[model samples]
Target: MAAVSLVSVSTVKPLGDRVFIKVNAAEEKTAGGLYLPDNAQEKPQVGEVVAVGDGKYKDDGNRVAMDVKVGDKVLYSKYAGTDIKLGTDEYILLSEKDILAVVS
Candidate 1:
Protein backbone atom coordinates (compact mmCIF):
# COMPACT_ATOMS: atom_id res chain seq x y z
CA MET A 1 0.00 0.00 0.00
CA ALA A 2 1.21 3.51 -0.76
CA ALA A 3 1.35 6.13 1.91
CA VAL A 4 -0.91 9.12 1.41
CA SER A 5 0.31 12.35 2.93
CA LEU A 6 -2.23 15.12 3.07
CA VAL A 7 -0.89 18.63 2.93
CA SER A 8 -2.66 21.67 4.23
CA VAL A 9 -3.05 24.97 2.40
CA SER A 10 -0.66 26.76 4.71
CA THR A 11 2.05 24.25 3.87
CA VAL A 12 1.62 24.64 0.12
CA LYS A 13 4.84 25.52 -1.66
CA PRO A 14 5.42 26.18 -5.34
CA LEU A 15 7.97 24.28 -7.33
CA GLY A 16 10.40 25.23 -10.11
CA ASP A 17 9.78 28.91 -10.70
CA ARG A 18 6.12 28.61 -9.84
CA VAL A 19 4.50 31.14 -7.54
CA PHE A 20 1.61 30.80 -5.12
CA ILE A 21 -0.50 33.86 -4.64
CA LYS A 22 -3.48 34.66 -2.47
CA VAL A 23 -5.99 36.36 -4.71
CA ASN A 24 -7.60 39.60 -3.70
CA ALA A 25 -11.33 39.85 -3.41
CA ALA A 26 -13.28 40.94 -6.44
CA GLU A 27 -14.94 44.32 -6.45
CA GLU A 28 -18.51 44.26 -5.30
CA LYS A 29 -19.21 47.76 -6.56
CA THR A 30 -18.01 49.78 -9.51
CA ALA A 31 -16.22 53.12 -9.23
CA GLY A 32 -19.51 54.82 -10.05
CA GLY A 33 -21.11 53.18 -7.01
CA LEU A 34 -23.04 50.71 -9.05
CA TYR A 35 -23.25 47.35 -7.33
CA LEU A 36 -22.17 44.42 -9.43
CA PRO A 37 -23.59 40.99 -9.19
CA ASP A 38 -21.37 38.02 -8.40
CA ASN A 39 -21.46 36.82 -11.97
CA ALA A 40 -20.75 40.29 -13.28
CA GLN A 41 -17.60 40.78 -11.26
CA GLU A 42 -14.29 40.39 -13.04
CA LYS A 43 -11.60 38.01 -11.94
CA PRO A 44 -8.88 39.68 -9.95
CA GLN A 45 -5.44 39.83 -11.52
CA VAL A 46 -3.63 41.11 -8.48
CA GLY A 47 -2.58 39.21 -5.39
CA GLU A 48 -0.06 38.81 -2.63
CA VAL A 49 2.68 36.23 -2.97
CA VAL A 50 2.41 33.56 -0.31
CA ALA A 51 5.01 31.15 -1.55
CA VAL A 52 7.56 30.80 -4.37
CA GLY A 53 9.71 28.13 -5.88
CA ASP A 54 13.43 27.78 -5.41
CA GLY A 55 13.94 29.11 -8.96
CA LYS A 56 14.33 27.37 -12.28
CA TYR A 57 17.48 25.56 -13.28
CA LYS A 58 19.29 26.75 -16.38
CA ASP A 59 20.85 24.49 -18.96
CA ASP A 60 24.22 25.30 -17.47
CA GLY A 61 23.04 23.89 -14.13
CA ASN A 62 22.89 27.35 -12.66
CA ARG A 63 19.67 28.23 -10.85
CA VAL A 64 17.92 31.35 -12.02
CA ALA A 65 17.01 33.56 -9.12
CA MET A 66 13.39 34.52 -8.59
CA ASP A 67 12.54 38.20 -8.93
CA VAL A 68 9.56 38.05 -6.60
CA LYS A 69 9.47 36.84 -3.04
CA VAL A 70 6.89 36.06 -0.40
CA GLY A 71 4.68 38.96 0.78
CA ASP A 72 5.12 40.84 -2.47
CA LYS A 73 1.96 42.30 -3.94
CA VAL A 74 2.06 41.56 -7.64
CA LEU A 75 -0.02 41.98 -10.72
CA TYR A 76 -0.33 38.92 -12.91
CA SER A 77 -1.47 38.22 -16.45
CA LYS A 78 -5.17 37.98 -17.03
CA TYR A 79 -6.60 34.49 -17.45
CA ALA A 80 -3.36 32.97 -16.33
CA GLY A 81 -2.76 30.48 -13.53
CA THR A 82 -4.87 27.86 -11.79
CA ASP A 83 -7.41 28.92 -9.23
CA ILE A 84 -7.53 27.15 -5.90
CA LYS A 85 -9.90 27.47 -3.03
CA LEU A 86 -9.16 26.42 0.51
CA GLY A 87 -11.69 26.92 3.23
CA THR A 88 -12.89 30.51 2.72
CA ASP A 89 -9.71 31.75 1.05
CA GLU A 90 -8.86 31.78 -2.65
CA TYR A 91 -5.46 31.31 -4.19
CA ILE A 92 -3.72 31.05 -7.55
CA LEU A 93 -0.72 29.13 -8.73
CA LEU A 94 1.24 30.39 -11.72
CA SER A 95 4.64 30.65 -13.25
CA GLU A 96 6.86 33.60 -12.51
CA LYS A 97 6.55 34.62 -16.15
CA ASP A 98 2.86 35.21 -15.67
CA ILE A 99 3.54 37.87 -13.07
CA LEU A 100 3.57 41.29 -14.79
CA ALA A 101 4.74 43.68 -12.08
CA VAL A 102 5.26 44.12 -8.37
CA VAL A 103 2.83 46.60 -6.92
CA SER A 104 4.46 49.40 -5.01
Candidate 2:
Protein backbone atom coordinates (compact mmCIF):
# COMPACT_ATOMS: atom_id res chain seq x y z
CA MET A 1 0.00 0.00 0.00
CA ALA A 2 1.17 3.53 -0.71
CA ALA A 3 2.13 5.70 2.21
CA VAL A 4 -0.44 8.20 3.42
CA SER A 5 0.46 11.61 4.74
CA LEU A 6 -1.45 13.59 7.31
CA VAL A 7 -0.67 17.17 8.23
CA SER A 8 -2.03 19.44 10.91
CA VAL A 9 -0.49 22.80 11.79
CA SER A 10 -0.47 26.53 11.05
CA THR A 11 1.55 27.69 8.06
CA VAL A 12 0.76 31.38 8.40
CA LYS A 13 3.81 33.51 9.12
CA PRO A 14 3.18 37.22 8.95
CA LEU A 15 5.91 39.44 7.62
CA GLY A 16 6.83 42.86 8.88
CA ASP A 17 4.03 45.43 9.16
CA ARG A 18 1.47 42.81 8.25
CA VAL A 19 -1.01 40.76 10.26
CA PHE A 20 -2.84 37.51 9.68
CA ILE A 21 -6.39 37.84 10.90
CA LYS A 22 -9.30 35.48 11.13
CA VAL A 23 -12.51 37.46 11.05
CA ASN A 24 -15.28 36.23 13.28
CA ALA A 25 -18.67 36.09 11.64
CA ALA A 26 -21.52 37.77 13.42
CA GLU A 27 -24.06 35.77 15.34
CA GLU A 28 -27.77 35.70 14.62
CA LYS A 29 -30.66 36.33 16.93
CA THR A 30 -34.35 35.88 16.36
CA ALA A 31 -37.11 38.18 17.59
CA GLY A 32 -37.42 36.10 20.76
CA GLY A 33 -33.64 35.75 21.14
CA LEU A 34 -33.50 32.43 19.37
CA TYR A 35 -30.78 31.38 16.94
CA LEU A 36 -31.33 32.38 13.31
CA PRO A 37 -30.19 30.58 10.19
CA ASP A 38 -26.70 31.13 8.87
CA ASN A 39 -27.93 32.68 5.63
CA ALA A 40 -30.03 35.17 7.56
CA GLN A 41 -27.07 36.47 9.57
CA GLU A 42 -25.01 39.36 8.30
CA LYS A 43 -21.31 39.24 7.61
CA PRO A 44 -19.03 40.13 10.50
CA GLN A 45 -17.05 43.31 10.60
CA VAL A 46 -15.08 42.32 13.69
CA GLY A 47 -12.22 39.93 14.15
CA GLU A 48 -9.46 38.69 16.39
CA VAL A 49 -5.76 38.58 15.77
CA VAL A 50 -4.67 35.14 14.76
CA ALA A 51 -1.10 36.16 14.18
CA VAL A 52 0.83 39.44 14.27
CA GLY A 53 3.63 40.49 12.00
CA ASP A 54 7.03 41.63 13.06
CA GLY A 55 7.70 45.20 14.10
CA LYS A 56 7.88 47.87 11.48
CA TYR A 57 10.83 50.01 10.57
CA LYS A 58 11.19 53.58 11.75
CA ASP A 59 12.89 56.49 10.08
CA ASP A 60 15.83 56.03 12.43
CA GLY A 61 16.30 52.42 11.31
CA ASN A 62 14.84 51.12 14.59
CA ARG A 63 12.06 48.57 14.67
CA VAL A 64 8.84 50.20 15.71
CA ALA A 65 6.79 48.42 18.33
CA MET A 66 3.74 46.41 17.34
CA ASP A 67 0.66 47.63 19.14
CA VAL A 68 -1.25 44.40 18.84
CA LYS A 69 -0.34 40.80 19.52
CA VAL A 70 -1.93 37.43 19.07
CA GLY A 71 -5.45 36.89 20.35
CA ASP A 72 -6.42 40.55 20.33
CA LYS A 73 -10.01 41.49 19.57
CA VAL A 74 -10.32 44.17 16.91
CA LEU A 75 -12.83 45.99 14.77
CA TYR A 76 -12.34 46.44 11.05
CA SER A 77 -14.15 48.12 8.23
CA LYS A 78 -16.66 46.19 6.23
CA TYR A 79 -15.84 45.12 2.65
CA ALA A 80 -12.12 45.58 3.25
CA GLY A 81 -9.16 43.24 2.87
CA THR A 82 -8.61 40.27 0.59
CA ASP A 83 -9.31 36.66 1.44
CA ILE A 84 -6.79 33.82 1.24
CA LYS A 85 -6.84 30.15 1.96
CA LEU A 86 -4.10 28.58 4.00
CA GLY A 87 -4.31 24.85 4.35
CA THR A 88 -7.86 24.24 5.53
CA ASP A 89 -8.47 27.67 7.01
CA GLU A 90 -9.21 31.12 5.62
CA TYR A 91 -7.29 34.23 6.63
CA ILE A 92 -6.73 37.85 5.68
CA LEU A 93 -3.27 39.31 5.35
CA LEU A 94 -3.43 43.06 5.53
CA SER A 95 -1.23 45.93 6.55
CA GLU A 96 -1.41 47.29 10.06
CA LYS A 97 -2.52 50.66 8.85
CA ASP A 98 -5.71 49.15 7.47
CA ILE A 99 -6.72 48.02 10.89
CA LEU A 100 -9.52 50.23 12.21
CA ALA A 101 -9.30 49.85 16.00
CA VAL A 102 -8.26 47.50 18.73
CA VAL A 103 -11.06 46.48 20.99
CA SER A 104 -10.36 46.49 24.66
RMSD of every prediction? 4.6, 6.1
Give the per-residue lDDT digits (tens) of candidate 1, residues 60-90: 9999999999999999998988888776678
Query: Clashing residue pairs, candidate 1?
Result: none
lDDT of all predictions: 0.90, 0.72
**Per-prediction TM-score to the true structure, in the order listed:** 0.91, 0.69
- Tens digits of per-residue lDDT, candidate 2, 19-103, equal 7787675677867899988878876767788877787899899998788888988777666666665455556667787788999
Candidate with best TM-score: 1
Residue 91 of candidate 1: its Cα lDDT? Answer: 86
Off by over 4 Å in 2: 1-9, 28-41
TM-score, cand. 1 vs. native: 0.91
